[model samples]
Target chain A: MAFGEFDLIETYFTHRLPQRDDVTVGIGDDGAVASVPEKSDLVVVTDTMVQGVHFDQDTPARAIGHKIVAVNLSDLAAMGAEPAWISLALTLPEINDEWLTGFAHGLREICEYYNCQLIGGDTTQGPLSITVTAHGFVPNGKAIRRSGAKPGDWLYVSGTLGDAGLALAARQHRQKLNPDYERRLTERLYFPSARVALGQSLRGIASSAIDVSDGLLADVGHILKASHVGARISVDELPLSLAVTESLSAEQAITYALTSGDDYELLFTVPEAQRGLFDTVTAHSPSKPVCIGRITNEPELVQLRFGDEAWELPEGLAGFEHFRKTELSQ
Target chain B: MAFGEFDLIETYFTHRLPQRDDVTVGIGDDGAVASVPEKSDLVVVTDTMVQGVHFDQDTPARAIGHKIVAVNLSDLAAMGAEPAWISLALTLPEINDEWLTGFAHGLREICEYYNCQLIGGDTTQGPLSITVTAHGFVPNGKAIRRSGAKPGDWLYVSGTLGDAGLALAARQHRQKLNPDYERRLTERLYFPSARVALGQSLRGIASSAIDVSDGLLADVGHILKASHVGARISVDELPLSLAVTESLSAEQAITYALTSGDDYELLFTVPEAQRGLFDTVTAHSPSKPVCIGRITNEPELVQLRFGDEAWELPEGLAGFEHFRKTELSQ
Candidate 1:
């Protein structure tokens, strides 16, 4: 290792961006000092990625860093908020210059891409883990939420799903994937794009929004539970990549789409009356949202459909529980 | 081990406090939505504690929880900021309800004590670790900075020091501590209070301030480096608890006071011209400040005094290096 904590931060992490008027002080202090815009509500979210649990020990440092920030940003996107600042807490078993550089590079890429500033953080020695807490700004009382979905709302999902789950299976050798499919799937798994622009466009149009981290079925379930409504989702309408559709059978693709995790796509609901507004807003968005279902008055009841036929999901395939085991999870 | 992530949070973490108007939204969302006071800058800080590295795995979950929040709050205190909100990222080996409840109790105590709300966070399964990011508000351009120390400033420290490090040493069997001393020291280690009130009071009075987490010598050294000045600290004036002074020799007490980590007390410097104001302000404080030294023009040169004799610290005793191993570190 070529650096201690202070030196490591100085060399690889400090002053990546030019000084900004909103930042009073950054780095090298008890805490960072920054200003929030007047009258804007701040959106705060955090996520932790642990070695052996969230990522393999041998995963490239760049991918590890990119995915951690991406996941947190995905949460902000689900709230219809724009990124502002982030704090990172990193625990590592050792200091490696190569790894640090790669991780910093990946983090910088996302920060630049979103124009978010790195404000404060902590670093310590332990089993490898990364915790990032992100802050964003949204117009007061205008942020999208899961509790706002009404019975007549239409459920929508941004971008594709199932590729990340399939990618993990292929890497674990549980599924045989063609070389091209494997490469594309792996990249999609590591660098899932957070749909910030689409989320912003849906601020007033979408009734409720949430990121699909724990598979479409489970995350959509959160919106239902929070909104006190039911959902009827067509499994055939689940967005899937070319690789997922080509590599897996119809049943396999549906299973991955429903039960697999780490997709990081936005799952939102649009009120029936505002469907036209939602369509017009998303039409200009970089990533278009695909409508998959409609909310119902029957609470806690989720109906799944494949074509015109109703499908029954097997028990225990309802996405991951942090404290419980879920088979074939990302 | 009976609960999933969502269940554990709902039972042990949510609704710990009454609804506040400032909190537009709280737990059970994509991200928390909070309103920051107008024209105030946010103080952001994060700290991570890992089991067996920062604390013993056998340590009580209550103390573990309190100390993690305490450490991060101390950082805010050092910046002369008022606590606003915090986000916790927790990674654990299992979901033992007993542990969760104890941890929650401890955390809630500090959150209530500081009037800071838990906004949002993530919980995952992994080696035990906790990361807390705190946000606070400081009036525009009024926050204290380490770089503000000037020559001829009187340096002062709030509360006592060295008990925590001595306690750690005793626990390691390096010293056979008296039972009472051991208990007091251990309590200080686990639940050290942040000098928030004192820090806030010193906002305009003190030239520079820093929290003594990594021992007075090292932390003061940071203020000196940042301010481009040196210090002459009287070692004889180092504060100690009754138990520490009686149980340890002068040299041992001084060693611990200079090198101990986790004190969480504030060390600040007031300009010579403001000495009267400093004394007047602190005399009314619940915890009075003790003047220990003076800032000098000699850059990077720290002089330690013990009455008529100048003292040199023993080598390799300069506080903590998180990435590097120190023999007596937690």
Candidate 2:
């Protein structure tokens, strides 16, 4: 039996995802209602994933659902916002009951874990794509931004970088690695955990912050441009996982750390005065935050240090420009 | 010169759109904020338009922008919500400055008229598509719904319906009309206005309501299914413009009026006590509302009257279905 739009919404979308008290109104209505506590502002972000561009057509429905939400949630985490509600716009070639079931299950699992509600969305027919708009709330003026880093502020990055990029390389069979290493890398690429709690805890604490979606060097360049400051990063301090280190040479790992993207880890800066507090916070974290660099007085210049030797990074740093052509050509 | 993401956003999207005081945060953040007045529930609706599926490549960018936002706003009007804020996800083939400027201008025009804020959004590269998520607010439980009609309620429709269908027929060269009539039909096809004010006024007045995006017969069928009732509609009472009547034969015009989509007018049911209020409200509207039908005790059946003759409408009503076979072959 073919289901109409209304029937599809009621059966699969309404009340299927997790519910939260903060959501005043949910699916089945014109829109949804979410509360922003007094003295706080809501943080919202939207991201769309197209079939061929973002993922392969054969990619599982569950992974597609999980990845789209994770990416938008990562933006909220970067802003130190507590996620509350999400709306999804799903465009598909056709409605397949099995695919919808798997997708909803994946979405529901994540919503439950994050305490967010799947409030409302529109489903249409088209080339397969999913757009998720997520909402989070933070105390007024407390949300972190890419600006505010001053000279001498220490730069820190939580967890490792480039694992996701490495995974992508392995998935496309562009590079070969040990079976275990490839599996680990692919897992990171498919299901990255957004650091929401860590970001919230760092509220009123970090001087500047951004999520590492692009490469470490390129994303940090954004902070430099926004804050009107430069940085000197220590090459040795980059946190590479044992799996990554064992799978690739030191030079290759260094290149990946600087240029590979899709890590979803938080990169932040802290003042010298709060060094002790930073230490305390890092000590309790599952992965310790590494001080990889220090902000400089100079503008529009980033330098790298390898022990006593120093090298100037190139100007016009290239990152993942969503629509622009990259060096990795077909 | 090729522009970076930030430069593109600042140059094209930032100040080019409408401004409103309800916007607590506009652009340039993880998310944007808009205030919802106390005792109101926020309504959100999202819709996506893909290049080949929704529009042709030759269609102007301005029309694409207008249609994306307009379709979503129509959903808000159906629920009697006040338009307040919107976020856009634009996936383009490439970043063309001229196209972006035209599109933004069209979007800005609608936002300014509706008192809505153009908040944050995401931009990416893919096959050209645009997704807009609109938000509005209404007093708690005051918004009209699809499932609220009673057996004795009077059914009414606003404005003319068949012009858009006539426009489509002209586009396909199946029918030809005078230039003046063609212009009117095309305008109705491309820029149909959402009856937000009419819907808001019908908040408590309309027991059940829906916007006629689908043809009259199909959309009314939705109301019947939702409200668990039937409807008796008069074919002659459907408001058709002289342009439509002159462009097509009487039988063809009646079919177009019954099955034409893209008329973003309200189709609603009101109790007998509120019948007098329609006259007061219609006096203020540019297009008058006309009573055309009555809700019936029978379930899942819709009948139409033409003078002394009555006929049962077919089981498959005309409307856009995402998964249905295309009518292009016909």
Candidate 3:
């Protein structure tokens, strides 16, 4: 029997998912209703992934579904909020049972891991695209903001950078790697983890936070723009995975780390007063936080250094622009 | 002077929108943070409009923008929630300044009227589609659900129905309408009002409620299925606008009202004990509520009546199925 839109939803999304206690009303309602705990603020974020634009056919359906949820949760993570509920607006060109099953599996896996619930959504027939709106919660006046970084704050990033980009490069045949490294890099690309726990731990310790989705330099620029402060990054201190460092030359690896997007790591800052608490908290983290830079008194000027020498980004390395025909853009 | 995604957002969407007092963090952040009232539940509804599926080129950009927000708000209305904030995930085929301007204008117009704020959103390069996730608030335990109706409840509908469907038929040239009626019908189709005020007024009185987007019969079926009860619709009492009544034969108008979608009127039920109170409350409402039917003890059976005579739906009239090749499917 051919599945209509309603049947597809019933078969895949409407059942067998994580159910949260806060969700007063879940699926099969005009709208989902949820209770926000008293003295807690609601954090909302939305992201869209288009078929050919965000992911090619080479990207697995499960990975596409996983990446969409991960990206939005990464935003919530950046805000130091506890992931709560999500709503999906899924548009499909056609109904393929295998693809839907795989996609639902991936979506449910991430939601389960984060203890988030799929509260409600709309599934319609259209181009293959998924838009996820994720909601999280943080205690009142405690939600992290990009503008909270002070000039004297020490900047840190959770997890390694550039592996996702390097994976993309290998997939596009712009780079080559050993089979083991290729598998590891591809895994990083397909299953990027949002630093939810680390972000929550940084709530009181970190001065500001942002997820590294638009490359390290561009995302840091966002912080500087919002906070009205500048930073000096020690390029030598940038954390790179063994896969990226082994597969590319030093300059190429650094460039990838600085300019590549889709690394869902938290780039954050800790003030001098909170550095001790930050270190103590991160010591228990699975991914060690690396302090690579410091916020500066200089306004809107980002200085880069290698050891004692001032450095510049390699020529022709640019940030991702979605509307432009950029080679590395997603 | 080409527009990048960031530039496009900054130019058209970032500024000049309504600001809500509860919005602690708005656009220009990884996520938006808002304070939900301590005693209220958060209501969320998402809807997507895809090009060539939900709308065509002839549909104005302004109407498209207005309708997307309106549809989601209608869902929130059905739940007896007050519209609050919205996040948009807009995928555009290309960046057209004029289209963006008109779309933003319509969006802002409705948002301003409803006192809803445009929170953070994501804009990407892809096919022309708009997915809006709207958030609202309702007092705890007061949200009207579709499953709350009891047997013998009086079913009521807000405003006239079938005008939007007639407008669509006229636009498709399947039927012709007088110029004056055509203008009125198309206006109904493009700029349908979600009964926000009236829905809020039904908070304690409505036993069950749903928005009539998928025609009368289909939506009534939704309420019946959820409530686990049957319904008997008095076809003679189905509300029809003058534009719909005058342009089509009686049977055709009824068919349009039963099978046509996108009217966005409220279909709700009030228990027998609440009739006197319901009438007293609705007396001050802007739109006169009309009694159309009653709930029955029979399960899952929807009986139609035309003044004392049993009636059946005409042949070839099917409900809108998004994935099916139905003639009137959206």
Candidate 4:
């Protein structure tokens, strides 16, 4: 069949996805209407992934669909909100049935897992790109903000970092890797999970929280800037997956952990007063989050220590930059 | 200066726009947090415009920005919701200072006029395309839907149609237009306004509503399909602008009015009992709405009349289709 825009949407997008009773209208109307829970504040997040800039032909269509949803939901996770609804604005160079089926499958998998509904969106013909705007709900006055961190708060990070970066490094021919490590690391790069439940659990316990999207240090810089506080990170304590650590030297693995983006883990802080409660609360969580640093009173100063000695950042370390010609990874 | 994504956003998008008290968290965060007033349902709409597909090089960057926002807001207007906040996902081929300035100015102008704030968005490097996801609110259970039109309802439209389509036809050299008509019709194409107050006034009055983005007939088909009813439109009564009438033959003008898209006017249906009340409610609205037809009991059949005689649709008349090779107007 010659696929029209509405036909493509109706065949691939409008059915078999998760549904919500709160959504009054979905897909067909000009706009979607949904009821927000009373006494809850809405958290809105939008993210875009453009072909060539964010992914390549080698990347799976399913992974592209999965990552776009994961990235936006990660933002809501940082705010301690429960994912509720999503609006997708999809632009495709052309309609390919195989790609559409795979993409929708991946998108539906994540939405079903997160229990969020696809409320409404627009599909247009253009370069292959996707923009997803996710809406979530947090109890009024209870959202975790990056500005809430204070001095003496213990910095923590969920899950191992650098695996995605390591995968990218291998793909770019910057490094050689074992077949086993490469397989696992590639999965890391393709299917990074947002720390949703962990983030929600830390809402009251963590002084501040942010998702580790733009590398550990750069994302940490955001919290420090917003909170007007400094941080002291123990370099040796940086989380590294076995796939990352075994594939490169220890120093290189640490560098990747510190400077790589696309790791959708939570970087957060908890005050000394809440340390006991935090530990108790996260005991049964998805991942055993590790303490890697502490907030300091000195504003905007990020101190790094390897064991008891001061450590310096690797020269020319860079993360993702969309407009800049030089980017660390694709 | 090296323009990075953060710098592009900070310099052009982060300041000098309308601010909202409901926005607890705005740009610079992972997501934006806002409070929806109690007893209101949230309306979400998203739209995307691609450079080559939606507009050509002759189109102004300012107009592109304005039209993206206006189109999304028109969706909210069709649903009888008041626009509240918008998130933009902008992908640009390259950074040009003048284009960015003009685009930002246009975006801010419409946002300021609508009293909606730019909350959160993503800026990426790629082919030029813009996606806007707009949020609005309406009283609980009061959102006008497309599935409520009854057989006896009076069909109404908010303003004159075909001006935008006339400009598009002129641009394609399908018809010759006077210079004055060209300028005015081009303005209609680029600067279409959402009938916000008129739609709000239609809350309990209009049984069904839709915006004329996919041509009047195509959009009316949507309402009919959703409502399981039909409509009878008087071809002679379709409100047409002097520019459209003067530029094209009467048949061509009627074709443009019925089959061309991009005119962001509200097409709604009011019950017979509510006709007087709808007139009273819309008396002070921005535009004088016109009743051009009436709803019919015959399911999914739209009848057209020119005075006392039944009218046939023009041969091979096509509306806007994103994926289809044939398009009426661009």
List DockQ for all candidates.
0.56, 0.38, 0.57, 0.57
> What is candidate 2's lDDT per residue for B20-110, written digit by digit as tens?
7766656765567556666776677777788776667766778777777888888898888998888888887677877988888878778
After best superposition, candidate 3 residue A197: deviation in angstroms? 0.0
lDDT of 1 by residue, B1-330 (tens): 111556667878886653556898888898999987887888999999998788886688999889988998899999999988888898888777789888998898898888888887888888899999998888888899999999999999988888888888888888767776777778898888988888888888899999998878778988998999999999999888887888788888888888778889999999888888888878887668898999999986888999979986656644243323342121
User: Which tens-of-lDDT digit does each residue in B1-330 have in candidate 3?
Assistant: 111555666777767788989999988889999999878999999999898888889899999989999999999999999999999989987778789999988888899899899897888888898999999999999999999988999999998888888888888889989677878888889999999998999999999999998778878878888999999999889988888888888888888887788999999999989989999988978777899999998877888899999977666543333323342222
lDDT of 3 by residue, A1-330 (tens): 111445566788866688989998998889999999888999999999998888898788899888899999999999999999999889987778789899998998998899889988888778888999999999999999999889889999989999999898889898888676988889899989999999899999888999999789888988998899999999999999998888888888888898888989999999999988888888979888899999998877888889999977665543233223352122
Query: What's the lDDT for residue A57 in model 1?
Result: 66
Scored by CA lDDT, what does every candidate get?
Answer: 0.84, 0.78, 0.87, 0.87
- Estimate, for each residue in A36-149, the C-alpha lDDT of model 1 and write its tens digit: 887688899999999888889668899988888899899999999998888888888877778988888888888889888887788888889999998888888889999999
User: Could you estimate the TM-score for every candidate?
Assistant: 0.95, 0.90, 0.96, 0.95
Q: After TM-score superposition, what is the CA distance of residue B219 in candidate 3 from its true location, in Å?
A: 0.6
Q: Which residues of candidate 3, in runs, are more than 4 Å off? A: A1-5, A318-330, B1-5, B318-330
Docking class of 3: medium
Worst 10 residues of 2 chain A by lDDT: A321-330
Q: Output the TM-score of candidate 1.
A: 0.95
